[model samples]
Target: MLPLAPSFDTVGWLTRDLATLDRVVRVMLPEGSRAASGAAIPEVLLSVLDPAVVQAFRSAVALLVERGGFDKPDDVELPDVKATYAAFRTVQAAEAWRVHGPWLTEHPGSVSGAVADRFRVAAAVTPDEERRARNVLAEARGALRALLAERTLLLPSAASPAPQASAGGAEVDRVRGATLTLTCLAAVAGAPSLSAPLARVGGAPLGVALVSAPGSDRSLLELAGALVDETAVP
Candidate 1:
């Protein structure tokens, strides 16, 4: 049988406000995975506004669960993805400042213009550091684009299938596992475009899950299990 549902406090790491977090989790989770039935609409709205909080919550959960790693079936390399993502984020931030700086100069009262002074400072870095930062940013953008273009799970298609359990229960287990995995992928793929929303809420860009199902506990467990299994091999 599946493990008992994780407590709200335990899952609370998924968001700051209990009500808002609960909504996102509910929408993303499947019926079988819910800890209990309740509406979390308020939590969802608040969460969308603070993407960083949501991201922090997600990262914490991933670390605790040991899923969503680079070596997992998802083929996400945390370090590499993070490095690339950070670089891209830097570039995006700089560009935003660059644009806002001039606009702010022209229209002082506009928020972007008002913030231009800070942007100008960020945009003006030491030559050597700036060059290195630019190079890293370019590389990161390319890497993200490539990842976005891919159609398959991160792991090699040739990786051996997970071993079957003992004979009598093996087929049932396999079918269940496969179904769960597919459901997880679907949910992750269908997640909202968090980039802009995150920026609007957090006043900065943060790494967002490319795929996540808000309320799908089974998917979460399956993903966590896959990451654990893959990481353990060899």
Candidate 2:
């Protein structure tokens, strides 16, 4: 689906348990792969954290420190995230236009209203904008990869727990903004993030995301499994 944007696009699974996912990673990666570990994990994506989400992360981090014997995570300097997000969006839209515009134009009637509008926006992204966005992606990957060379990153999977099924439009938008804020860090950096389902609010499940440099998918999965095992979360 991401022809022009293949550099950043990847495929993975979502599940109820991290251990099962870890086993799948074990089978996929080459033998003798080792998970990376170190102090000084740079944490990000706090601007969108809901109160409940914040609490869940704090609890999860405490568990990790107590059980895994890791130091508490501290804030690390990062580049302009808003700019990074804009760059990712530009590149993604440019590529989406290239990959999906032809068929969508031929069968315009088959597309949903919102999706068609998105395609229209993609079809309008300028080449200059795409070039700038690609530069931002490269610089971001370089910076984040250096930060993650020996340490992992921690973030919330979403801004908050699952919204009530009856949530209104404004509420849904709020949730989406928060989710994008946290998720784009990994996506734009072309890293793999393992979702750890260690949080609950109002009896609904949520996740704390653990992200690492590219090529560390196996390590991320294994670390997530250990977090679950130590805390007996899922």
Top TM-score model = 2
lDDT of 2: 0.72
Against the hidden reference, what TM-scores do the models get?
0.30, 0.87
Q: What lDDT does each candidate get?
A: 0.35, 0.72
Model 1 lDDT at residue 215: 38
lDDT of 1: 0.35
Best by lDDT: 2
Give candidate 2's TM-score.
0.87
lDDT for residue 155 in candidate 1, whole number 0-100: 15
lDDT per residue as tens, model 1, 210-230:
233333444443433333332
| Collision count for each candidate, in order | 15, 0
Q: Pick out the ten consecutive residues of candidate 2 with the lowest summed lDDT.
A: 32-41
